[model samples]
Target: MSDGTGAPVLLRTDGRAAHLVLNRPRALNALNHEMVLRLGEALTVWESDPAVETVVLTGAGERGLCAGGDIRVVHADARDGDGSASAAFWRDEYRLNARIARYPKPYVAVMDGIVMGGGVGVSAHGDVRIVTERSVIAMPETGIGFVPDVGGTHLLSRAPGELGTHLALTGARIGAADALLCGLADHYIPSAALPDLLADLAALPVADAVARHARPAPGGDLAAAREWIDACYRADTVEEIVRRLLDHGDPAAKEAAETLLAKSPTAVKATLAAMRRARALGSLEAVLDQEYRSSLAGLGTHDLVEGIRAQVVDKDRAPRWSPATLAEVTDADVERYFARLGARELGLAGETGEPGAPGAAD
Candidate 1:
């Protein structure tokens, strides 16, 4: 039975599996507050439903599962309105990410294509994550002058070697194999096999359904490049990291250096700090709390609005970052992003001190 509510998200049940479909194909299923609330409600219901043995998440369109949150709203609020609305939305959305992380039933995520930012939040944390040949996963918030949120810092911090740092500062996209190597996804199932696999999920156990479709992802760039990625990104500061990348003699490393130069200096610096702190914070909830602070801090910056204007609004492809270069981003500037939100805190990590993924060797 399908929950035909004519909403941006669609809910349905088939055999023992319940599906949560992101339905806004026109916006590439960019999640809004309403969809987040609906998803939370659906998950709450299905968590206790005796017949639902598996919960599957998929996007409605051919493009991908989800792009991310509705950032246009964030851009608007930051530009014209008080920051409260954006903060409220993030509060609920981050809570949903934590819920999905701890969801007890088999939570299966179909990560087929174009998943980034909030999309990574909803899918990467699931117990059963399936990526396809078409899958392109990233945490690309820095490009728009926002640090990665929704436990993205936590996930990225746990990737192999300095892979997390490399991705955090550069906003690099990875394919299925790299996603697997970085621990962002569990299996690689071809796009062609997805329909049949989804149908099998309706009647079979998640492990069984996935096993029938899973295959080795043939190509990945990260493993071969780990030496330079780890060495270059391990520096204490972004500027030092850039110098290493430029001097490393690999064309790819130089390209990464150029990529870093192009991002908002403030955002890239804050992200590096966030990723490092996330490694020590010791849990997803803690990292999310930190990211929330970074996000709200971003609301007060000129670069956040300007970066969005250049990249998304005006389509100019050239963002004039405040403070301009990595050298101008001071320690105080980066530290301010980690300031406490106090009463506005997400508070997901009650009593704190849960374990984190051990620091990857850099």
Candidate 2:
């Protein structure tokens, strides 16, 4: 079916296996409202279909599985001071994230290339996450003056050591091996072999098909830098983390410090808090509820607009962040992001309170 943007997200079935391809190669298969809705609808149908025992998700071209949600649309909504569209998109996208996390049937995702922001949301929660040498995974919302959403708080909260904190704060891109080490990806298969792997998946058991093609991912920088990452990111706040990184006097630490300094101070602080709070939450639904609140709060801020303008629209690579420094982002400001929305709250569990069910508010 068409993803409502002329680009079609092709869906096909072969015996007990179903394949869903994100089909906007030119745009790197970036998700739009129609794609999100269609994907959720498809998953809901396939979940109960006895003929569909497994689902394989991938992007159409070699560029990537998905770059992210159509942020340009978000930029327009926020610019026009009408967030209705943005809110609707996020609500449905987040629900899809919850459904993927709870999917009963085996769900395999081929994170072959660039996967960032909303792309990470879709693939990271799958039952089997396969990355390749070309895979470049990151949660880059902070760079756009937004904290990681789409249940990113929960995913990052569970990463090994303080690597989650490091990733959330710096928006660092990681390779296949690092993805495996951080629990983000399960297997590493070469991109070329993906076609054969998909063929096997259609003909064999899910586990056996994957086992036949999965191979060891090459070593990456994250493993060697884990000690430093934990050391620098374990601090109580973004400022303290920067201090630790600077004091370490190493190239990686210095680069990380600069990256953190470049993001919106409010986003950095709020994301740090979200990751910490998510650690205590027991469910993905709870994490998404918190994210919904945070996203609304972000929409109320000026930094998101400026950040997107500078980074995506203008390509200036320089954003004039309000409350430019971490010191200027008061604790109260950060706390406001986590506040419950009362009547406007997101309901991932639906009216029946069944998690991953389809009756949620849009």
Best by lDDT: 1
TM-score of each: 0.96, 0.95
Predicted candidate 1 versus true structure: per-residue lDDT over 68-107, tens digit per residue: 9988899999999999999999989998998999999999
Error of 1 at 77 (Å): 0.1
The lDDT of each candidate is 0.90, 0.88
Best by TM-score: 1
Error of 2 at 107 (Å): 0.6
Instruction: State the weakest 10-residue window (summed lDDT) of model 1.
Output: 353-362
lDDT of 2 at 131: 97
The TM-score between candidate 1 and the true structure equals: 0.96
- Worst 10-residue lDDT window for candidate 2 reads 353-362
Instruction: Give the TM-score comparing model 2 with the true structure, all chains together.
Output: 0.95
